[model samples]
Each structure stands twice: as structure tokens, then as C-alpha cells.
Target chain A: MRSSLILCTATRFLLPIILMFSFFILLRGHNEPGGGFIGGLVAASAFALYAISHGVTYAQQLLKVNPINLIASGLIIALSSGLFAVFNGSNFMQGYWSEFKFPVIGKIGTPLIFDIGVYFLVLGIALLIIFSLAEEEEEIQ
Target chain B: MNLIVLPVILPLLFAVIMLFAWKYISLQRILNLVGSLILLIVSVLLFTTVLSDGVQSLHLGNWKAPFGIVFAADILSSVMVLISSIIAFTTALYSFSTIDNERESFGYYPLLNTLIMGINGAFLTGDVFNLYVWFEVMLISSFVLLVLGGTRNQLEGGIKYFTLNLISSAFFLAAVGLLYGLTGTLNMADLSEKIKLAGDNGLITVISIFFLISFGIKSAVFPLYFWLPSSYHTPPSPVSAIFAGLLTKVGVYSLIRMFTLVFTVNSEFLTNIILIVAVFTMVTGVFGAASQNEIRKILSFHIISQIGYMIMGLGLYSVLGIAGAVFYLIHHIIVKTNLFFIGGLIQKLQGTYELKKLGGLYKVYPIIGLLFLIPALSLAGIPPLSGFWAKFLIVKAGLELQEILVVVISLFVSLLTLFSMTKIWNEVFWKPAPKDNPEISFKHFTLSKKIMIFSPIVFLAILTVIIGFSVEEVFQIANQSANELLNPINYINKVLGRF
Candidate 1:
């Protein structure tokens, strides 16, 4: 898109902050209103902003693993989290809680892990689509 | 974990595994075969368990029924899953020989496994919203499979297939929303009980129509079937065969499930509408097949015609009728998939699907011709074959109901179906090969490739014959499945944990 210098610099500055906010949203999802889906969208938009200002290749470099790999790993993590219940003698996707709490994170649970998996999945899929579209546009140019 | 959820989970797990093994095509094939074999074993085990234990229902996350996602497998769901696994196993085997490396490299195996997972999930889900989610999963994977090659024909077909399906999904979602608004439940069993209490409201009838339109498009019944013929023949043979075999049947299964389990059948108006739709669907589908020259297209239109027979069983809404529909569904999946596989072999040999350009198969490859005949005759309702039994039950049900006009139309449709089969037999097999046609010698194909192609066809054809000869056993299962449908008490009690 070749935006103006101010917009490009602004995007570069805001990207990390946006990604951190997305992680915050994901972490609060299990008990609060924000969840993995919305969190992932926020993160994807940050990267999308970077791709637009800098170029897709730079965005690709930042994403060391392919989006497909991210998607697969995310799904595996999510599915295995569900299987934790089976090993614990509960039904599939049954949530198990541990007493340990880390800093401000409260109780650790399988559902939270599931939510994190969803976060990565949604982020990867969104970037995959956006980046492909951006690259195709670049090729046309 | 309970075995009830294995059919859905195993395929999903394999799909993810295949994604990681994407760079290794041979390894992916090995994984696909092993996964499919394991799925078949799981499905058969589940079916046996259902047979012995009655319906099995599991609540995900240990949440109680009507609140949590429930996976319930009754005789009907178990049998459907078993047949689906069988077809998937065969399709996996056939794809080894038929699907090109380009498509394989593009994640075909993963998508296929994901599609199986979707089908299993759809078959077993007890919640309406969960069914919608599974449909989306199935549809997305199917959309990818349809256009994997990126050929012009494939993309064109993909557009029509996906767009219409998306519309159907929207209709399905809207109907789910309205039903929830009225009854305050999305669970099938709970909805069944509540809808009964709600009585024969005109709004309920409208809701039924919404469901009818939505599922009708999916099953390609009657006037809403334009997208099927245009799209089904575009994919690679194995992809098309699996689509031909499983996809529409899922729609029909949903129709049977919703109408039989959820909706009250007190309205004669609804039954009459379905009856009319069934007759017209049969007539139109067979007529469409008669006009087609391409092998897969002919088989594609025949799929629509065969669907009418299944819907007729539902329209009858009798014990025998539903049983007949169930039997027809099982028979059609095996026969239709085998026919498509044979068509693929024909295409491979002759390098064309057009009837005018294909010939001399009977002389050159008698075994292939015989393979073709089994499904062809069975599809035409010849005696001692699966199709004949399927038709007999439906026709007998019609006669018992004294639906003379529909019986006549059904009989005439069978005759017409036979006519089209003969057309294929004559043009593709009986006629002499045209001069200048390159003879496709069997010498060109490696023995393993030949085995890969032939084994699935032989296995499915043998299944059709076994089902035909052992009609009593198959019919008994269908009858029991039908009885379960006719009475949903067990299904409801199990899912709701009322027992």
C-alpha cells in the first residue's frame, strides 16, 4: 500500500503494543468478556498493519513458522487439552483445575489452555489469509 | 474417553498429524491408510457396542445434557458411521493410485481426514447448533477438496457448490435460531419433547418448511438440485466418489433425523408436500441422467434420482417406509461410490468420460465390465442385488399405503434408470473402439497401482452383493433402526440421561 512515512512509522511503533493487548485479552478470556477469537483478531490486525506499512516479506520473517504449522499446532494443543479430561476419568473436553496460581493468573485450568490454542489458531488463520491476499496483490503490481 | 466420540476424534487427530507430515507424501499415504483402517475398526466396534448396549450418549466437559454438547450414537448413527468409514477407507486406498501429486502436496489427505471428522461429528451430534458447526467443518473441507487442483472446471464447480451450500447453511442457522426462540432449546431430544408440548402451531409448520428447504438443497431434492450436477463431476475421481457417496446422504440422514426425531408428523400437509417432492425429484433426476453423455455426470444425476427413493421412504413415514429408506441409504452409498470409482477407472483407461469417445471395455477388460455391471444392475433395481431390495421395500410400502400414483412413478423411474445404465453399457463397453483411439493397455499400470484401483471397487461390489444375498440380516438391522426412529424414547432418555 506504500502509506506515508508518518503512518508507516506509527504502525511500526504500535504493532508490539497491539500484540501485547491481544495477549492480555486472551488471558482474561476464560473469566471475562474477551476471548481467544476476539483476541486473535486484534493480534492479526496488528501484524496486518505491519504487512501493509512494511511489506508482507517483513511480516513473513516475523512469522518464522508457516501459518499452516501454527494452525496445526494450535489444533493439536486444543484437542490434547480436551483429552486431559479423559486421562483424568472425565468426559472429553472436561476441564480440570489445579490449585497453583501464578502471579495474577488465578487458577490454572484446561479451558484456559484451550482458549490459548484458539487464540493461536484464529491468529494464524487470519494472518494466513491476509498475507496471501497481500502477496497476490503485490504480484499483480 | 467414551467410544461414542472416537469416530469424530480419531479422524481429527489424524488430520492434524497429516498436516505435520505434509512434506512426506509417502508417509502421508501410509498415515492415511493406517488412520482410515483404525477408523473402520473404531466404527465397527462402536456399531457392535450400540447393538449390545442400546444408545450411547456422552456429555462433553461433563456438563449435563441439554446444556452441554452431547454426542449420542444410536443404531442409526452407528450404522451411518460404519458405512462412512468403509467408504473413507476405500477412498483412501483409491486416492493412492488416482489423485495427482499436486493435490496431495496441497494438503488433500489432511482435508480428507478433516472431512471424515466432520461427517462423523454430524452423524453423532445431539445438538442442533453443533450439527451446524459440523456442517461448516464438512463444507469448508469439501470446498477445499473441490477446488484443490485449481483447474478452471474445478473452480467453477466449487463456486456453485459452496455458494448454494452457504445459502443452505444460512437457512439452517436461521431455522435453528427461530426454533430456539420458540422452544428455548437446541438439544434434539429436548426439542422433541418441547415441540410436542408446543402442539401443532402454524409457526412450527413454518419452521419445518424452513428446515425442509435447507436440507432439501443439501440433499439436492427436486427443483433445488441444479448445483449438484454442475459441481459433483468437477473434482478428482476419489474426491467426487466420496462426495457422491457420503455428502448428500448426510443431508438425507439429517432430514430423516429431524423429521423423525424432532418434528411431529401430525400434519398431512407436510407429508403430502414431501411426497410430491420425492416423486418429482425421482422423475427429474432420472430424466437428467438420460440426457447426459459423460459417465460421471450420468452417475451424478442418478445420485439425485436415488435420493428420491430415500426421501420417498421418509415421506411415507411408516415403519416399513423408514426402514426402506435406511436400507436404500446404505445400499446407495456402496453402489454409487463403486460406480464413480468404476467411472474413474474408465476415465483412466480411455482418457475420456464422454460415452461417444469410450468403447471396447467388455472385450478388452471383461473384469472391469463385470465390475461396472454389478453396481449398474444394482442401481437399476435388478433382483438379488442391493438396489432391488431397497426399491422393493419402498414400493411395497407405497402399495401398502395405497399410494398408486407414486408407485407407478417409482416403477417407471426404475425402468428409466435401467435405460440409462444400458446406454452406458452400450456406448462405453459394447461398441467397438474407434480407430486412432490409443489403446490403454494394462501393461502401462504397475501392479500395485492396479491393485490400489481395483481392490476398493471389488470390496464395495462384494459388499453390495453380500447385502443383496443376505437381505434378511441387513433388513433386520434396518428394521431395528427404523423402530428406533419410529420411537425416539430411548434416544431421548439416553441423551437427556432421564434413565
Candidate 2:
């Protein structure tokens, strides 16, 4: 195996940049292109890179909670954002837009928030499917 | 703004909350049981509202149709929602007695809740693509539950199940793609109007056949049925019970909805094909049922046969035919699930769902044997029970249509159904128990398990009796749903804003 120095250096140097770009992709999703699903996939890719260099055991140890819980949480958030319309006396999954302007952030709506939830859900489910399957592959090792 | 969205929302929220409390058995159990009870109330509220007001809709985020999402509830949908959740509620109760502690710890409640979410979402969705997503969600969750044990039997069965389903999904996706290209819209109501305007054509038939192949695999109709008996038998009791109870019925429900709404214009071609499929499906399925030695496996084969009766109603494509199908669906869903649960009870009491290994249950638990007998003969379509009425409507529809061959096949199938039920009685309850076998004792059951398992079966079995006695009211409800399905302008206007 390669030395731990190479792996640690890669994760430390690359993770923040990857996360920043993921948010960039998510924020621009409504008009220009990149959306929650793609952003989530990108963020998950960063984690995959980390898990690879650091070893899955280290990644599991570093994770505060299980990936499956993240998936459930994401589903709740995504579903709730849609249902909020119902509670608000609007129709289900009817996009609720709110106008906002910020110094750093450009604009946001319930769509963006919903997108964030979808992002997290996709990321979590992807990781869960990948890592578990990987672990199973390793168990057979 | 429609009221259709709440039923989907509340359970999805519960599914998430239930996940957090999965470590605490008591908390998860409370949440799931309470969650399903909440669903039942929500469904009832929806049904009563829709019954009065007709179909209601909520456009997501106040977005207008053809632009943003729409969630809808109609009289037909709301009633089905009620039936589905009530079944889920009862099954959750059944799970308490059947699932081991390890299953509880493995996020069972959360997954089950989510599975219901997927099921409800599929039922309630107004859009076709959204239906596909929800179908995948339910199927994936179900696949996990099927393979939860990872035992040799489960793995073997899981592989078969997954392969069959993966092929189905590929076809489903292709059909969706083709339909999108043809219609340029994924909304079901919108597609209906457009399709009617365009009129029935060869391309539409191609798309419809694609869907039939996809759903037929799921429904396990005729030749697509082998995967079901082998695979459904491998899951644990709760899985088997719920799978037996609700999932395949979802396939049948969608098939009924789609054909009536989108594909029935070519009545001679499509309807005649469905009739033949129904006939073949019934004969083959009953033959399979007659041949089986295992309990749930036999019941599994019978699900295919019963789907034939439902198809008969649909294939006839009349008010009487569809109403009969709807009534039969409601009857079959409850009775079949009850029989499966009785199979579970048989397993609990006798330690097997095998006919060869079980006998003389009438001596020890005569009440259970009685409870069991009502559903068994009812399933066999004997008179004065709910099953007879369901079949009566379909057979009457056939006679009205003068489809003598189809009607004759339906009769032969019912006779075979009776033959198989008698086979079960002779093997399981009438004969003496084996001398060497140990009997299940009271010590084996906990109080919660008893309430959870027995109550729902008893309640549903009673409802079956009530439906039989109250055939007029049941027929009215079915007739109303069928009228709405046939004259979909009501559903169409409600969803697409009177265009």
C-alpha cells in the first residue's frame, strides 16, 4: 500500500475545495444547470476519495452517525419541504418561491431548500449502497 | 389547492422519526403502530371529504398544472388509500408477534413505514414518471426486507426476485421513455385527454403492451407467475403476510386504472387479450395451487388465479365489469391477506406452513379453525360470503357481455379454488396431528403479539362478512368508483382544471 502521508495529504488538501464546489453546483442549479442530485453525487465522490485513502474502518470511525440515518433524515427534509405547502394551505409539491437577496448568497426559495434535502438524500443513499456493498466485498476477503 | 397531499406527508414524516428511535424497541413500535393508526384516520378523513366534494388536488408550491407538480385525491384513490393503510396498520400489529428482537433493532419499523410511504405515494401520485419513482422506492425497500435475513433460502429467493424485477424495471423505463416521446407529457390526466384526442393508434398499443409486460411480471400473471410462488414463500411471516396481502395488488390496481383510463379504446384487441390472459391465468394459477404441498406457496399461486377474476372484470370493460373488478379487488385483498395470516398462525401453532407436516387444528383451536374456515371457503368463492359477491359481479358481467368461454373458465377456476381449499382443510385441520410433533403452547405468545396479530385478522374477516351482508352499499361504492374511472372527465377536469 501507498504511505499514509500521501492519503492524509490528499484528503486534507482536497476536501474543503470539493465541498465548496458542491455548494456552488447546488446554488446554481435552478437557472444555469447543476442541481441537488449532481451536487450530492459530487460531495459523495469526495467522501469516496477519503474512504479510499483513509481505509473504510477509519472513515466509519470518523463518521459521527451512520450513512443510512443520513438517508432517512434527507428523505424527511425533502418530503417535509414539499408537505410544507400542504400545511401552508397550498397544494402538495407545489413549488413555494420566496425572494431573497444576500451579500454572498444570490437568491433562495423553498426549491433551493428542497434541493438541499435531495442532495443530502442522494449522497447518503449512494454512500450507503456503495460502502455496504464494498464492506460485503471485503467480508468475503 | 387540493387536500390530497396530507396522506402522503404524515407517514413519510413518521418513517423518518421512526428511524431515529429504532434503537428503542418500545419507541419504534409505538411510532409505527401509532403512525399507521394516524394513517387510517387520515385516509378516512380523505375518503369522507372526497365522497362529498369529489376529487381534490394540491399543486406543489402553488405551481399551476403542466408546469409544477400536482398531488391529487379522488373518491377512488381515497378509498384505496384507506384500504391500503388499514392493511398496513394491521400488518404492523401482526409484525409485533412475528418479528424477533433482532429485526426490531435492524430498523424494521422505519423501513416498514417508508415502504408504506412508497405504496401510498404510488397510489396517490398524479404523474406517470412520479409513479415509476415511487414504484422503485417500494420495490427497493421490499427487496431489502426480503433479503434481511441473508439466510440461504432468503438469498436464493432474493436473487430470483431481484432478477425478475430488474427485467421488469428495464421494460418499465423503456415504456415510460416511449410514452414521454409520444405524448410529450408525463401527467396521467393530461396524457388521458391528449391520448383521447389523438385517438387510439398502433404506437399507443405498443406503449400499452410495454406497460402490460412490466406490470404483468409484477402481478405474476400466467407465465410470469413462477417467480412469485418460490420467492414469496421464502420471506418471514410478516413479510410473507404483507407481500401476500398488498404488494401484488398494487400491480393489479395500476393495471385496472391504466387500462380503463388510457388503453380500453381498442376494446376488441386489448380487452379480448386481457380476457384470454385472465382465462389462462386462472386455469394455470389454480392448477399450480392444486399441486402445491406448502401452505404460503399454495396461497401465493392462488393470488395469480384471483388476479384473473379481477382481470375478467376489467377485460369486460363495462360499468358492471369494472365495478365488479373493484368490488372483487376490495374483497380479495382482505380475504387473501387473512388467509396468509392464518397460514402464519398455523406456522406458529404447528411449526410449519407445510400441508404434509400439519393436521387436526380443529380439535385444539376450534375458534381459529372457524375463523380460518370462513376465509378459506370465501376464497373458494362459496355463497353468502364476500368472495361470492366479488365473483358474482364478474361472472354476471361476463354473462351480460355474452363472453361464455370466459365465464365458463371463471367457474372452472372457482371450482378448482374450492378443491384446493378442501385440500388445505384435509391436510392441515381435519386429520390428526403427528404423534411425535410438539404443540405450540401459551408460553410461546406474548400479550402484544396476540393483540397485534389476531386483532387485525379478526377485524378484516369481520369486514369481509359485513361486505357480504352489505353488498348493496359495497356495490354502490364500487359503482361510483367505476363510473368515475369510466367517465374520467370528472377526474380529468379535477386534475387539469376543466380544460
Candidate 3:
């Protein structure tokens, strides 16, 4: 309950960056250890940590948006990413590839987009649950 | 292609829309309505698709073999999802004015949507570990919803509900770990295939027991019925109704699916153990309901008793039996929710759930009184009501198996159920009016509350009527659903790489 603003704001900015990092974990999860589920969970942990330090209201305000829309957008993004795979004649959630050898960025695929969708979903649902429960915790007092 | 994934995705998308629009009641209403509409259409389409295609599987990320996550949907899963979405949509409509301002935090709208996600996910997931995860998603949301208003009673009940379920989750995880260790695959389809290859081994039996312990607690079957009565009575009627309608059914659905497809039913050892549990559960639950003084408490106890009937059918392991369980489950969700919603309305009118404190509401709210009878009689297995057909099929299953005792128990329980329902009628509606009291200022039927509460009853009552007359059709669908569950290869072939 004793979370600081610097920690909070730092996380407010830092969590997304960290979540973005987890996206790589999901993208390469098929070949290695990480994948969508775990990556999504990490993103959830980011929102949760921020919510704990900031009040639930602040967390919602921090998103500067309603949590539901955030979740919806994530779902659409995830679903459409899957749809993209389907369009490419792959199965739902099938990873698609479009790689270019840039100077720095190496091979990347459509799975990265799916991970972003998952990132928002995990964060949104997790936030939805926490905020809903936290609202009750406040009421009890 | 996996029909199961659609249920999870669609409402999830809508839940977001509802959450954003939560502050604007009209917009929230529209989002909830439109979202449910889309889900309903999708469910119907999926149901038709499954009927024609047998099963549809989608491997996530198109990765082949057991490495990638998979989703499978067969007839049973699709139909169940359809029913769940329909109930959810109707309940959302029913909640419009009834959700009380204090309880109507915008977040709740999303929570409802997520709750659907959990249920749909649980129903459609093709793997064991994933099912466990889906169960958690569904359940934790129920816990929050159960105690949403944070009334003192709700808190006490919610804590117990949460703790017991958390323990159940641990048991489920333990089961999953053991099964995964033995079978090396969490996908239900793959597990079904492998479990057959394993062929009635000792490890499988142990794992089955672990699953029984876990799902048993969740389904609120015998020995685990303690938590239901204690916790269920606390929440507002709508919350209680939804909990009654959806949550426990997930447990029952899982039990039937796993036992029939994966664990192998009636292994003599398994069936006999379940049969014994069924009898005791039936007796205890009926008696428990008979003795309860509170309306929701009685219904809660009745839920236990009703689950006994469902399990008895499953234990019989006959086609008719499993089909009966499916019908009973579908019937129970709608009927029980209707009854609870009515109970909530009664509380609104009389300001109490206590049977002793109430009387003569028939004069005050005749339509509601009539409304209560429809589901009550249906619940009690009266002839010409949907409840009768549920029991009839189960009894037919018992007769086919020549299990006379189970048949007799089912009959006696039906009578007792009727008696308990009548007691509520006698006390709450038929008896002479109590002296005008402070709690119920004698003013009844606000336009908004009437619509909010009556809609659930109207819809369910219509379903009761439809299902009653359409017994043959309902039974056919239920039978096919049961058949699909018993052989989940069709499901697995669709979700994972085709075998």
C-alpha cells in the first residue's frame, strides 16, 4: 500500500517499456521458452504494480482511459493478428513471418504484433480485476 | 476454425466497450446489448458449424504438434457456449435497473463480460492446464462479483467462497501436474488419445481421484456442500442468480467431460464410488432444502440436491443418463437464476428473505406470485414443466441400468422438492398478510424494478415451456452433445494438428 509517486510515475512510464521488452519474449517464445501467455502475464504484473502504488482510480486515470476499452482494443488487436495469420493461409494464432535485415533490427515476424495484443489484454483484464476488487476494499473502510 | 475461441473473444471485446461506456448508462446498456447480440449470432453460427463439421480445431500461431497452444470446439462446447452467451445477454438486460447505484461501478459491467470470458473459456478450452487457468479466470471474477457491494454478510460469505475455491484451485493444479507428468500432454484431445493408450493404469486412477477431489469441491457435490449454503445467501439476488446459473455448472460440465472422455467412466471402482456419493448427496441436499427457512438459502441447498441428480445420470454412464445430466444442467441454470431473481424481488417487496416474516404477497404482486410458481414447479419436477423432462430422462437412464434405488431416490427427492417449494408459496404468498410493517412501506412495483426483475423470469419461464414441449429435440441435442464429449477425438483433431 505504501508505494511512492516517483516509483509510481517511474513505473507509469517504465512498465510499458518493460512490457514492450516482454513482447520479445512472446515473439520468440515458439523457438525458445517465452510465448504469449507468459508475456501477457508479465504485462499484467506491470499494471498491477502500478495500481498498488497508485490508487486504482489513479491507475485508470493513468491509462487516461476506461479499462474496458483498453481490454477491448487489446482483444481486437489480438484477434485481428490471428486473423492476419488466417488470411496468410495459416491457422488461428499461427505465427507469420515478414523479415528484413535492417542495420540493427534483425528477423521479426507477425507474432510480435500478436504479443502486443496480448500485452494489452493481460494488462487490461488484470487491471479490471484489481480495480474492481480494490474499489470494494475502499468501501469496507 | 475453433468455435470455442469465438465465445472467449467476442464478449471480451464487448466487455471493453461496456467498461468504457460504463459512466453513460444508456451507452453501457447498448454496448452490453449489442455485445450479447453479436455473441448470440456467433454462438448459433458456431453451433450449426459444429453440427456440420463435427469439430473445428485451431492451433494458436499455426505451430504444429504438441508445442503450440490449441483450441477445439465440438457440438457440445459450441451449444453450451451458445446457451451461456444467451443467459449472459439476458441477465445483462435483467440487470439494467436492478444493479443498484452503489453496486453499479463501471468496472462491474466489464467484470460481467469477463465472467462470460471465463465461462466461455472454460467451456471451450481443449487442454487441462488451460482449463484450470480458465476456471481461475471465471472463479476469481465470481468472487469479486459475489461480494461486489461489500455488505457485511456478503464479505463473510465471499471470504469463505474465495478460500474454498482457492483450495479447489490448488487441488486442480495438483491434478493437472500429475496428469501432465503421466500423460505428457495437457490438451484434452491428446490426453483422451493418450489416456486410452495408458489404459486403466494405477497412475491414471490416482490422477482421476485428484481430479474428482478438485472438481467435486467446485461442483458442490457431496461432502463439499458446506460452502454453498453458507456463502450463497449473502449476495444480492442478481449476483446470486448468476452465480447459481453459471459458476457451478462449469464444474459439473468439467466433471462430465473429463470423466466421460478422459478418465473413463464406471470403471467399477469409479462408478460405484460416484453412485454412493450420488445417493447420499441427493438425500442430504433435499433434506437440507426442506429444513431451510430462508429463500436463497433453501435454493442454495437445492442446488446441491439438483447437482446430485446430474451426477447420478453421469454415474450411470448410459447415453440417456449423460444426456439427462446435460438437460438438467441447462434447465437448472435458467430455472435457478429465475427463482433467485424472483427471490430478490420478493425481498424488495417484503424487505426480508425470512419465510416467517412474510405473507400474502399474492395480493400485492399477483404477476410476481404467478411468476414464482412457473420456475418453482419446474424445479420440483412437476408434469408439463421442463423440470419433469430433466428428471424423466434421468429416471429413464436409471431404469435402463436397472438401478431401482437411484430411480426411487430421484422420485422421492422430486416430491420433497415440490414440498419445499410449496412451503415457500404457503408462507410468502398464500398466507394472510402480515401487519403493514416499516420495512416494506406497502408500496410495490417501481416501473424500473419490475422490468429488471420480471425479464429474467419471463425469459426463463418461456424457456421452461419451450424445453418442456420440445423434450424430444432437447434430448436429441443433449444426447449428441453427450456423445461428442464421450469421444473428444473429434474435438482434438479440430484444435490441434489433425491426428
Task: List DockQ for all candidates.
Answer: 0.71, 0.59, 0.45
TM-score head-to-head 2 vs 3, winner: 2
lDDT of 3 by residue, B1-499 (tens): 6445778877777776665566776777668778887888888898888887677777766665466666777766777787887788778877775677667763666778789999988888777888998998898788888889888998999888888888899989988998888878887767777877876588888888888878988988999878788899997777788888888888988998898878873267888778778888888999999999999999999999999999998899888888899999888888998898888878877788999888888876787788899999999998788999999999999999999988998899889999999999999988877676435433565777567667767988898889888888888889998877666666666655665
Pairs in clash, predicted candidate 3: A29-A34, A68-B16, A93-B61, A94-B61, A94-B62, A95-B61, B57-B494, B57-B495
Predicted structure 3: lDDT = 0.80
Ranking 2 against 3 by DockQ, winner: 2
Instruction: Give fnat, all candidates.
Output: 0.78, 0.75, 0.69
Model 1: CA > 4 A from native: A1-15
Docking class of 3: acceptable
Q: Which prediction has more favorable DockQ, 1 or 3?
A: 1
Question: Model 3 chain A: which ten-residue window has the lowest total lDDT?
Answer: A98-107
- Chain A TM per prediction: 0.94, 0.87, 0.70
lDDT, candidate 1, B273-343, per-residue tens: 99999999999999999999999999999999999999999999899999999999999999999999999
In model 1, how well does chain A match by TM-score?
A: 0.94
Candidate lDDT scores, in order, read 0.93, 0.82, 0.80
lDDT of 2 by residue, B273-378 (tens): 8888889899999999999999998999999999989888988999999999989888888898889988988888878888878987888878878888889888
Question: What lDDT is reached at residue A26 by model 3?
Answer: 71
- Residue B220: error of model 1 in Å? 0.9
What clash pairs does model 1 have?
Answer: none
Model 1, C-alpha of B318: deviation from truth (Å): 1.2
